[model samples]
Target: MLLLNSGCGTKNKNSFESDIIIYGGTSAAITAAVQAKKMGKSVLVVSPDFHLGGLSSGGLGFTDTGDKSVIGGLAREFYHRIYLHYQKEDSWKWQKKEEYGNIGQGTPAIDGDERTMWIFEPHAAEQVFEDFIREYDIQVYRGEWLDRENGVSKSNGTIISIKTLSGKAFKGKMFIDATYEGDLMAAAGVSYHVGRESNDTYGEKWNGVQFGVFQHGHYFRDSISPFVIPGDPTSGLLPEISEEPIAPNGTADSKLQAYNFRMCLSKHPDNRLPFPKPENYDPSRYELLARVYASGWDETFDKFDPIPNLKTDTNNHGPFSTDYIGKNYAYPEASYEERKAIIKDHEDYQMGLMYFLANDPKVPEKVRQRISEYGLAKDEFIDNGHWPHQIYVRESRRMIGDYVMTEHDVLGDKTVPNPIGMGSYHLDSHNVQRLIGPNGYVQNEGDIGVKPKEPYSISYGTILPKKQECENLLVPVCVSSSHTAFGSIRMEPVFMILGQSSATAAVLAIDAKIAVQDLDYEKLKHRLKEDAQVMLLSERLK
Candidate 1:
């Protein structure tokens, strides 16, 4: 088990420690706290975000729920709460449920026992997450960033307390690392791996074998010259296209998945604030996007699904879209100031892209006019001037825990014994890097999209570090998995389910006075079932 460094003093402040200490205000963190509270445990949720829900309330109103049945416990309860909110007739401000399209982008919206509208507005989601906190009367410390360098304290291979950046310290018998990047796991000195692992390492077909293959047909001809000299080595590659050969198949590398902001836009004239030219906006940075438009790519307007008030939750789609690929490699481990700079760079790039699409003379008139009709929603994210409060952190440092969930486990060949939750989304990895293909074509690599036959089990051991590595910490967001395997497990709903399970495991460990790695699977499973967690795939499919 990984042992954390003991602090200089032995005194534990705040004599009464909570049963569980969650170090984030994300959807996962809140869900974990709520679950722990339901089990009659004193729970405290400390978060860096002033808001409660992370991305769930942060402009991702159109949920990425694959198989909704697998979502149980606090996750299902969250949706149920949403349903109750809409039960009030006044909740439908702009359009009635019957008028709004229930289906979009291949996912169907069905009315269930709860009146919850699966897809909703950003404000509505935040209200539901807030209501959960109020219902449980859970203690919450907002704007508390973890002191990563030297804040965590431990005793005999178990964490005793963790101090936030503001110097406020919280001590607990059990700790749950629910942050997307696993900051607490790292600060607690747990073992973790970053970037992609080769197919050979896992003996899986999809892991690293399909690096440069673009199944979505998003690639373009390299012969079509962007520069004065096309393919000559002396001429140098274009702005976004890297000259490196797609890393050879079945080889481990440090490349990470792409990230982007989910823009909340609106067409309502009064509510919409027209896309503005960002500070330091450069026309030349969008040369690649200009070229894409020149190549007859007009699918940019396809992903704007309408929410309430004529607003849309715009997502990334097609080539040269919102995903600023290859620009976020240093983000997962960067300093706070550096992270701010990176977030600003992404904000500037995305905002400039919108402005360019709406105003640039080079863009096709129809595309320009279509994009110009929409703008930022004025009411949402009021603190950040209606911009998305959270950036979409697609993938980050994954713990190399006791049992690594490889592609085979997700594909159903290997049996995952202690299934804590289930994931049914396709193994979808966004483009890693832009490269020049052998046929003198400009191509994008690392965008692997493969369908799963059925929902697969997410192993319990994946949530905890190896028995010899870390003892008290439970990681739900960045669970142990191969790079490709993570693609399926990385969903909002699945994270919530795993969060509930992680908190349950933490509480069980606290009561047993044993390391998290030593918790009996049978007992844990029993507790999970008692708490309404769907631990098996068959239970969900049925």
Candidate 2:
């Protein structure tokens, strides 16, 4: 805990350090910083995004929390802040609270907890995140991306410092990798894996192999031409569908997850702006979608969950919707400009899709009008043309830590030694690849949805690397897990929950002058419980 200046022109050395340095501006990142601060440690949050919350404030107002009882500590405190904002009565501009009661995709609203509403408005969530930063007095450096290749420096398996893209060096006693990509952990020389592991590798029934499952209505029963030229092999597959055959059962391969816009639409005519035709709008790009419409598929508005006022968080649906099925392969490792181009491509594809449904002669009139009634909310995401700033990063580089949680662990057949948090969402991965079936029909692969019998404990070892790998880095957002296990643990609430626990462990490690992997679990658990973290089900009963 000393400030040093290694002066120029000499082998000069001085020390400058913080108790904890958190990367990423997601809700989880903020939660972790707040927890560290509450532990009387100085903390700083460096984020790639200018905005505070990741997806929670970035258009996904309707949360995807499975079991609300499991969300506690700083995560629960975040929602409570949202509830407090709404109590002002001025927060409800578009609709009343009574009209919007306990309605979401999978979870029920908790009547006793005012803060536990499963659904909310985008601005409300953002404000809540901002309030946390203000109240905790956490310092945040926005628009700063980490230089992953050489950003992290370590000695004796402990992180010495991390430098940003702008060469702004941050020296912290402990660091938390709260990014979805696990960039910090990877850069720090910790082992991690991208894409799925073959199911056989982990003996996981749901890990790498996914066959003959259609939970999201993304399969076609009949032959649909995937190209401009109908039924001609020479014409080749369309831009969206890949030429490669879907890998066989239990095979390990990298495939793109579906990408979609979390559209913030409104029925309020004053606030609604019709989906615009993107700059590079190509009608041919939507041939598969047109074919889907031709097949009597009419579930376009199925996921327009209501928020405050008449606003809705619109999502993808049917065989062809917001999810750009096979185009995100280059995204996880792409450059910033490349990521922008990919994002723009998705925007065009999705916007053109909306325009096609609303104005194209081929679309059924009823479906067109239903989609036409909705438009982007002018008030939300004003900085980004009312679109979601962050793409829904479903899966990324998962750290392979001391303990890797697998399907067996989530199924309650196995238990983790050091429990940090709990997650109950069904193991869910969106379709990974589009393929031609033996029946001469196009189909989607890698869509697995298996429900866990009960909520399972997330291992503390999953968040910390082995002592010899990297001692000071804690990965909360991208924890150690197989692809199948990550499916259940990837929820936003769970990330925030893990963030708090990770930060607690970071502070404790610094105080004990020990590596994060060597922190005493008894002390960690005691601090977590005192701070209202949900580490055990029996603790909740008490």
Q: Would you estimate the TM-scores of all the predictions?
A: 0.94, 0.94
lDDT of 2 by residue, 1-542 (tens): 22222221212232235678898988889989989889898888889989888889877877877767788888888777666776677777767766766566576543344455667777888888888899988888888888877788777787777888876777877889999777788889989887889988898777664757666565665567776576776877765676676566878876646767777788888888888888888787778777877776777788888777788877766666788887887777777788789888888888888888778878888877787778888888888888878788887788999789998988788867889888888888887877666554567787777888877889999998877788888999888898888889998899999999999999888788778888899999999989888876675522
Measured on C-alpha atoms, candidate 1 has an lDDT of 0.80
Model 2, poorest ten-residue lDDT window?
2-11
- Tens digits of per-residue lDDT for model 1 on 1-542? 33232222234553225667899888999899888888777888889888878888888877877777777778888877776776677877655766767763345543554444567778888998888899899888888899899889876677878998787788777789888888899888888888887777878776663555776655553245544255565776666566666667667778787888888998867778888888888877777778777877778877787766677888878777888878888988998889899999899989988998899998899988888788898888888988998999899889999889987888887788899888878888887777666666666777887877877889998898876666888999999988888998988888899999998898787677789888999999998888778878667732
Model 1 poorest ten-residue lDDT run:
1-10
Q: After superposition, how far is residue 170 of candidate 2 from its true place, in Å?
A: 0.7
TM-score of 1: 0.94
